[model samples]
Target chain A: MRIKKLSLQRSGLAISLGALMLLGACGKKVAPPPPPAPPPEAPAPTASLSATPNAVDPGQPVILAWQTTGATDVSIDSIGPVDPSGQKQVTPTDSTTYHLIAKGAGGSQEATARVTVNSNQGMQSTSNATEEQLFAQNVKDVYFDYDKYDIRASDQGSLQADAQFLQQHSNIRITIEGHSDERGSTEYNLALGTNRADAVKNALVQAGISGSRIKTISYGKEKPFCSVSNETCWQQNRRGHFVYEK
Target chain B: MSNSVRAIYRASLIFGLLFLLAVSSSAQDWIRTGTGLGVERVRLAAADFKGSNSDAKNPELLKTFNDVLWNDLDNAGIFDLVSKSFYPLQEPGQPSEVNFSVWSTPPPNTSMLAFGNLGVASGKVTVQGWLYDVKNTASPQVLGKQYADNATSEAVRVIAHRFADEIIFRLGGGIAGIAETKIYFVSERTGHKEIWVMDYDGANQQPLTKLGGISLSPRISPDGSRLAFSSVTKNGWEIMMYSFDLNRVVSFPRFGGMNLSPSWSPDGKLAISSSRNGYPNIFVMDGSGGNSHRLTNDQGPDVSPTWNRKTGSQIAFVSGRTGLPQIYTMESDGTNVQRMTDQGYAVSPNWAPNGQFLTFSWMRKYGPGEPGSNDLYLMDIASKQWVQLTHDSGRNDFPCWSPDGRHIVFQSHRSGGDQIWSMLADGSNVKQLTFKGSNTQPNWSWK
Candidate 1:
């Protein structure tokens, strides 16, 4: 009877050891793979544009428009080529809403006009504007001369009228974007674009506009309105753009 | 061996967490050497002939002195001579009757007065030239005249160049041996940039090294027995110490990375060069590349270290530690660091043999966003004062001093392309020396 009890105790101990082994096998740790890096953020899309043409002639019209997003204060400037294009900042103009255009890190976007400029029609003042008139906008393409980073003499009178509109409506802000042709290196062109934007800013300052109200940046030799490999397209490519921020 | 080992050990133990700048906000678009591509210019005035119309019959001999000056100056590569009758673009050779108003209006980069007296058989090439201050000819400082053997056409070039040297010397500049000196540079007219020895000014550019790989940064030893330079082959790049006296080549103590920019000790006992040690720093080795000693810590970047003979054991090199490439002085074994300049830019500090002043590029920012606006400046080592040397546009760099300490050879992009140039130590008489494909990296051979 005592021998039988010893054998039964030994079997009980073996059963316990088997249970421990099964538990160890089932509890083996396994690491999960690292979470994949978050996908890159997509650039914001520009929903709409607001264009306002102040001056309109063969030389190029004062293009005032709005990206409606990005940038705090937007403004327009013009250095005319009336005489040698040397030190000629914004020709005499009468506009309320200044031109503005801005670009972020992704694809570039331009603004349409906040004021319609019938190319055939001359500069018009927006003095006593109704709510409906103030809200209306247009879309037009303005051109620049070769190597000249300024609003053409033809556009000044019109741009000034747009400036008058902005002055009347002080609640608005805008960004001035400068652009260049693709003939030169990108780095230099980028700098050139900045120069163009600054040139426009200088004109705005002289025209009694607060510099703090306008901001600027250069897109360089990137993005073109006309891609045809010709002088005509390049002329269209070099420009000082205006887009409304507010 | 023990002494060298001790030096190395001392250098290693003293190595600290040195602060150096490899990347900087003010990086030079061009590795400016602070010298210009100045070639000495000479005028071959037609021997004023005055006799009966028949007396002009023997005008060729009268023109002999003029011919000699032309050939010699041409051979010397010192002059951009327009023969009163040979320049292709001119009104057939008559220098358009020196329109002083026009020339004076332009304010010539160099001012020279050439009055020639060429008469019949007594071939006397008397060139009374005055080297004036480039910025202002307030003083008719340098004047020289050459009296050569009248009969021979060959020796006239020599006598004229001698005259040029005298004037050059009087201007507190260099005595360009337009009459004798030769240039040793790498010419890739062949597949590789081989060592080519040519006339000082730029004529007779010939290739010396036939080695298949790339050979550059050529140096003429103190004795000029062999030319030391860097070469790249299928095996690797090496700081090659070639025995020119024996026409043989041997590379010393090959480091794992690139080895170049060798500067021989004052006594020719050691050659210091840029060796790869995680980064480029100065290393001193014997002629055979034995007993090597590293002189610097892991600084950001160090290259173009030249010996200052005045200090004897100190070297002036370009270091990029302060967010820009500036001139710094360290012991030959890389200790005792000191800064040199604070304003604008400095590079390629070519020390005078006397070590009183260092020639470096000092490019100051002129307009906003216009950064490459730079000029050559001379810095007095003791006073830490700078004398702005070059004022005009274009690039001027790669300054190498002459043995006499009066002249410096450098690469200047003044003409829109790189070429060799020389000027006085006092920042005067910048004359272009080369008119061909981008030639640079000049080292003067005293021999």
Candidate 2:
């Protein structure tokens, strides 16, 4: 009878242990650890620039077009900052290179276009020519009447020659320097000098030379080619001298 | 300290205090007694200043100060400075040490005496100057001044100038002396012509503008704060302004083509010549180069406008209306035109401070085969009566007036090349101010 009572008590303790283990397993099932995270992504963008009708006569306008994608800011050299995709008209005196830069969160991308200017006078063949050579062969000083800015009939031939040379060498730039004799006041002579130079420039434009190829300056009475105070010397001083750009 | 020695020092200090008080109270009663319309220069003597300290530097500095003071008084045009050899053997540095009989004796026989004491210590300079009227035996001292500054050559020269100006003011019939004023000019010393400044006596000369190109026609503002000039840049000749206070080139907007020859109005408005409208003409703009309005509309050039400081309404300029440039005066609005120079070629007119006369460069015999020589002339505006100030003195031009209206500073080619010169308003006391390379276009300071 004592052995039978011991077996019954042992069975009861086993059943209670089994019930505690079952409750612990159910709580573990309600909350579990999450899976590992995925890797990060990489960023990117695309941009390009192009010029249409890349070559043209001097003073003729050229159109510049650009395109970009996913860029926060975009800019073209000399054209300043611009929209991502745009078109612009430019009239450049010389051959120029346009570079476009597009910036984004990831990085930046760049592209370039070159416009080759065609000279009307085949100046590119003599790109390494000196100013003295150009001035001596193609251009000559134009004379003006005393205290007058009007282009004299005698100087018309010289202006015609200058215009022809400029039309042939479209890329070449020239400065029309006006000077006056030391007979009048220094300040008044300066104004007269300007008028003389402007007259020459206008004559060149009328002769089919582009105005963009010409610049004007007046030395007044300050700078005289002839220092003698005679009419013969004064006539030489009152002239529109030509200077060629390299 | 010994009791006897201390008692003696206290008694001397009290006596000194009482003497200073008497001098201070009597200083205001002293008045200049010379007539302004006299040909006689005030005879004066400048004694070597006593050295307060016998240090090595003190003697040299004292000599510099004394020499500069003597030279200043000698060149003032109003003084007959006594030679040092004829001065009294005793060089009295203070009123107490001066003996009236010694300077008033036959050899020097000076009407006035200037004496001072100078010292340098601890990198500082100190001076005590006194001007004594030799004829007034009872109250011999006419002026007393004390100056102190950093112990430098410039400081010493400045102290001497200040002392000399005081003496000139006291004896120059209430005329403010130009010793402390400056002369602005253009110098080609540095290869390129640039603006430069010097003392009125041409002592300290230094370049003010280092612009790498040509600069001309420097005109100082009435307040002496800005210098307006013309400079050549890549664009062409443009009017430029240099602010003395800022010590840099200030922005003066270009009004387009070939702006040149800027003259400041009495109220600081700029009167500039511009070719913006295809021809050069006089235009007035605000000091900051805004609010521009055409003052003259002639087809010929109208430039070099100088304002009448007395009345800001009138302008004197060079007009080429009658074929050749001549001096003309008109209202500020370009109305009521009247020609001052009837026949000769005249330009660069500078109105006097009192506005009663105009000084300009005129060639009496202008035109072909004429013996034309540019000389300075003074014209009475009301009567048109003119007097030639310079007689064949080699192409003198750009005459500017001193503040007192007693002297004129001008540029002359008398010495082979262009140089700056000054003379009395009556064409006496001609003195060369600049001897350096090719200096021209002198504009005296307003003060």
User: Model 1, range A39-93, lDDT digits (tens) per residue?
Assistant: 4654743424333244434344443223334332222322111111111123222
Q: What TM-score does structure 2 among the candidates reach?
A: 0.72
Best candidate according to DockQ: 2
lDDT of each: 0.51, 0.77
Where does the lowest 10-residue lDDT sum fall in candidate 1 chain A? A79-88
DockQ, per model, reads 0.01, 0.04
Which candidate's lDDT is highest?
Answer: 2
In the range B215-330, model 1's lDDT, one tens digit per residue, is 76777776778777876543334677777666777656666444556777666645444434434556787767778888776543455677775465778876555544577877
Residue pairs clashing, model 2: A120-A168, A121-A168, A121-A169
For candidate 1 chain B, which ten residues in a row score worst on lDDT?
B16-25
